[model samples]
Target: MGNSFSELIKNFDKTRDYMRDFYIYGFKTRNDFQYKSLRTYDDERRRIESWLGDFIKFSNSKKGKQISISCDSSKIEENPLYNAYRCKSFTKNDIQLHFFLIDILEEDNFISLNDITDRILDEFEISFDPQTIRMKLNEYIKEGIIISRKQGRSLVYAKSPDSFQRLAGNDSDKITDMIKFFSESAPFGIIGNYILKSLDKLNNLFLIKHNFIVHTLEDNILLALCQAIEGKNYVSLVNYGKSHKKTEIKCIPMKIHVSTQTGRRYIIVYNKQWKRFSALRLDYIKSVDILEVCPEYDCYLEKYQKNAVYCWGTSFGAKRPKEGIEYIKMTLRIDEHNEKFIIDRLKREGRNGSVEKTGENTFCYYGEFFDVSELSPWIKTFTGRIIKLESNNKQVENRFYSDIRKMQKMYEVK
Candidate 1:
């Protein structure tokens, strides 16, 4: 049909791949994408422009016109990238049947499948097989768009009662506020953003600080991992590292950890074969397939929770001690008169660690974690105020000093 044309997309992964490229490595001409046709690039660029015209920008480069999306996450309440999820492809029959079925059930009457099909042929002058109509109706039933009841020997379908009016009764404003907050704060918040769009509402009520816009790229992968964890299922996934080398792993999905400082996300999973827990970055996961349920899911979950307090971040540590623990102690010089905030910070970000006063304007922080190395960066933050830092792992302790010596050499410090 002269190169089929449609604005909506069928495969979201293709859209996601192109969108991520555009979002991450912007300012590229169509010629930059040597693998795809110019037409393909044009179509996707057009599609994204249609969705995020406000954020789309163009500039002239020496080679050609460059297209890019410029979005300020802190300036906007909702993620515009979420628009990619809302554009869905539909066949001619699917669209036609949707209107026909909704128009037929508009009168609040239950109609049998055969009768519905006949009405479409007669009233709408469109004919679809009765079985096709039945399947469509069943699909709608599962989606809560239609309700069905047994009528004699046949099943009949009718439009489900709309709950929008009920939602608008009293607490609708509060509900909208909740959704506004959720759309920016929650994982898979694109769903909430879609709901807000359906309701024709704008988020004028809330603003999220430190919102991580790039994280929306990993939502689809996160959704799969969450489903697997919730069902206590094993997942087989393709993971790739910085070098883009692929590795296949089968593990029990456990938890999702988000870093407050960097806004990166990781999926914590347990590998039964290795008998160890490891965290994989969400972005590194290429694909995931849900597998059979893990019968020892609860036992593994309890063990993880018990040992989680010892985890500095997502790592279970390297060269774990025989006792499965590592210790760290830091003494910081604080001006108790004015630097109580430092002590408060040590207490706040210490996780399961303890802080106690050792002497006037001096405090000692003791922590036991699965990996003391992971805490090195955090410890470095208190560089000037650090009186002494010690770790049970000599490598971790020496590495800290080694880094300081390198910095001193670089700065030509005496």
Candidate 2:
């Protein structure tokens, strides 16, 4: 069991079992999907048990033990979990208790039993039996190595800072920093469960235990949005804006947009009654109730795909080009600094348009009119970086100049 060959064989078998289960039945939590294949269950259980045992044995080894880990309190404070806890429906008592527990343990350091127990009772006012307290401490200790020193009749227990340092030092900090930075800085609409899950799995593997309340909320919203997009049915949602509106809308969710520049997530949906495309912010949707029946729109998915390109918002109209495609040629004079950005944008909106580099610092963008108006603001954004060279529609040029004039007048006033 200690040898490399033995470990390799054991791990290989465990991996094979996991792969078989994943392929046969996918992953099923206790509350979800009930139709589990016997083969999948049998394999999954074996793999999980094997992994647990291996991890335990590994923790007992010399290489797995540590004394301290490096952690930045400032970084943790800015995590999405902290924000989620603030917004989520957690009781005040629960929040206080959870924070107290975390504070007593002090993430990267070790603490004695007497100190921990006393702090818990004094701060949380909970007096558990010594045996029960020990049991609880042991559970967390098992997840990581606990360094202990004999003091009087009691053993002072603390996480091995060395072990923590080892875990933290090995790419965990980089990953945590990456996730934390992106989650906080990313545009509001850009946050999604896929990124959250990715961060969580990475943190779990690296033993970088951090808060995940926001990630949980993100997952719930993503699941509901996905269900709606599949034409499952109408959903009852409460808007979180100033008005605090509540309504049940039968919507055909068409597309999800993640802005590269802003990093926000937006869902474009066809509001049945409005008979128009609507952009909904994922975070503002308080709750969603799935419907039993699907939508009755014909070619809704096709229409969404055809129009959701190079567009900022959902506004595909009836007068859209023939067979739902309209083309427009726009010329822009871009400087060297803005050339890369414009090229990237053109690539993303491929087939909807084409770009030709006319000069050292100029390009022409010709694209179909799925939602040309949406591009107006984006074109204006490059005022200092680019100039509109030519517009197929004279009205478009006039509108741009009109907007610029209005902006100039507004800025001109002291």
Candidate 3:
């Protein structure tokens, strides 16, 4: 039986050698297909060999001297192949075994099989079966070396810290300890460092947390919209109307708008049946589904881009004169206290214009809007501080009065 096993091993080695030689020298084709295949095989073999070497090193580590590799177990579990073979016991043992090896390697800077099994049994509270340990280590080596290192006559093992911080060109034990501390405490430190490193190349700097639910939802919405657009599929969305009722609408998603006022993102979609552009709040989108058919309209993405500054919401479907400019000129009286507040409000609402000091404490503000309705409430915010000098649109003037009246009624107490 031993002779047969030896023969089988010899045969496998010979076969591998033959394939390696064939891949290196025997591939001569104009199509480049065979050459590509040979290159891929070589790459794969190199990768496998590298990982195997690391695994052997990791398995030979001593107690409290293992290399720790930073990896999220939950992420690994998400893969279907890994999930299938993953058992709770296996995961627990694997993590402990890796940690144990890491500790041993870090302490002594080298490890052997004898040291590893003994420490595994002692620290992990698992009875050491040499055969089982050997098999598992070999299997893990084949899988990948999450963290490991080679040393004289044996291997050292450890976990990869989440991130690393460089010391001041000084190789000190204290700095190494600090690196470990930061890795354990601040996993995102590495990510922040990378961002700062390439700040010069970035057009915009957006600092956000990965686990933030609102940002996650916004990203999902954008992804879905891009997918729909690429697939030429229409979408059915549920939106909250003026009546505050959930209204179902089938629309072709054209563009997405992010509002600085509320820090909320919205979708600018063309409603086919209604033949108009409707602004749908991303949060209010109850559900979205891809439809089979595409809408038959020349998408006005560029036109919307050019007129975004004046536009109110995404309702740009209404036809207006191309040369006409919509202006909402208003006079506001502000005390020294409210002057800064009004300017900040204007910037928030994205109303572009200039503020000129008309009086000692008052200012004349002139702004253009595609729809004055959108700016009415924003203007009305300075109820006591503002008095309308002229309003071209009666609806806007009425809305300001209505808002003021509502505020007055709240204080009426009659």
Candidate 4:
């Protein structure tokens, strides 16, 4: 329907425009999209329907009729809009000139601008001005696709050396195999996947347990933020929270954390205005554009490293005298003969903590961690085994008791 569908991998100007609008501001009525005329609106609507007809839905309400895409995010195996970044559009002139220059230029000979233009007209019957040809050649030179050399008073152009198989003959096979694995496993593996596909060596040998669907479409954004982090730069993020309200923030991105169980990702950023580390869900971030390198980026990194010692989960506690520092000690009367695995789990899950045998069958897991209240779910698993539970935070103790009381009342246990 659009130029993106015509090309395999490049820019799709029309597809980008239509998709960008729908993605950023979804659930909009016909009146919400203010076009110059009704015909223009209908044209765009038709184009959108053509691309995502299966996904799109219409609804009527007191707020007037609206159009939306009903997608079960958890069930989505592939993001449809991923093609927008892959397929790029090209002009007729670009196609003609690319072939013209390739045909005229030889590997050994260096041809001048005037000679190249004359040859293009004589050989291919296509007459492009010297200025247009010069511009295109200069662009190619910048891209390192072609080479230019100064011969006498004139400048000449030639093709660059072929470097397809850059690896040595001995290690080419090993390197190719590594690329195949990295293409599926790495964070920005799509680039490697593209290369592998071109070589026709594409195979899904590694079957990952948590194959995140959003990771494919979100790779472009992830790459930009990663680059910014490496450069010690700030990123202006247009993020949406649980409320679906969009807000913009200029933050110095520090760390990226991924939950192994959920396959969810979060980025920890230092908010300049708030003067604290704020964690934002990666999926909720609508857009991120890199800004100038921050002068205090290194300082922020050092501060984060120091502060990370207290962080239990993703949350960095609020500013206070001690900053919500607390420890939770969960002592259980575990019957090792019946459930030896419970003792093993305590030691395994307890990071930089101790699991001690207080009695023949009792074990005490004593750990000081920030946000111990977040560990309530894990504590509940040892309901029958829990002999004693203690925490420095009063709120945690109160909530633990409150939950036990609720369970007792519900089960009507004496």
Which candidate has the highest TM-score of all?
A: 1
Query: Against the unseen true structure, what C-alpha lDDT does each candidate score?
Result: 0.86, 0.52, 0.51, 0.74
Q: Give me candidate 3's TM-score against the actual structure.
A: 0.43
lDDT, residue 408, candidate 3:
86
Tens digits of per-residue lDDT, candidate 3, 117-183, equal 8887777677666666555555555554324467676654443442233322465445444443332
**lDDT, candidate 4, 1-414, per-residue tens:** 554333333533344445555654456766766754555556656655655667777778677776665555444433445434445557888889888888788777888999999999999888898999999999989976689999998899997765447533578667767777776667777666666765777544554555553455566567778999999999999988889899999999999877665556789999979988878988677678999999988899999888777666676766641557678888899888988898899887666568999988989988766677767777887888888899988788889889999999999999
Ranking by TM-score: 1, 4, 2, 3
Worst 10 residues of 3 by lDDT: 77-86
Off by over 4 Å in 1: 1-7, 24-43, 57-68, 106-108, 319-324, 409-414
Please report how far candidate 2 places residue 224 from its true position, in Å: 2.4
Question: Which residue runs does candidate 4 get wrong by more than 4 Å?
Answer: 1-85, 94-124, 129-162, 332-344, 373-389, 394-414
What TM-score does structure 4 among the candidates reach?
A: 0.70
The per-residue C-alpha lDDT of model 1 at residue 126 equals: 84
Q: How far off is residue 335 in model 4, in Å?
A: 4.9
> lDDT per residue, candidate 2, 289-354, as tens digits?
766555464576666665566453545644433444444556666665856876776667544567
Better of 1 and 3 by lDDT: 1
- Worst ten in a row by lDDT for model 1: 316-325
Model 3 CA deviation exceeding 4 Å by range: 1-219, 229-250, 290-299, 313-326, 335-350, 412-414
Ranking by lDDT: 1, 4, 2, 3
RMSD of 4: 6.1
Give the Å error, residue 379, model 2. Answer: 0.8
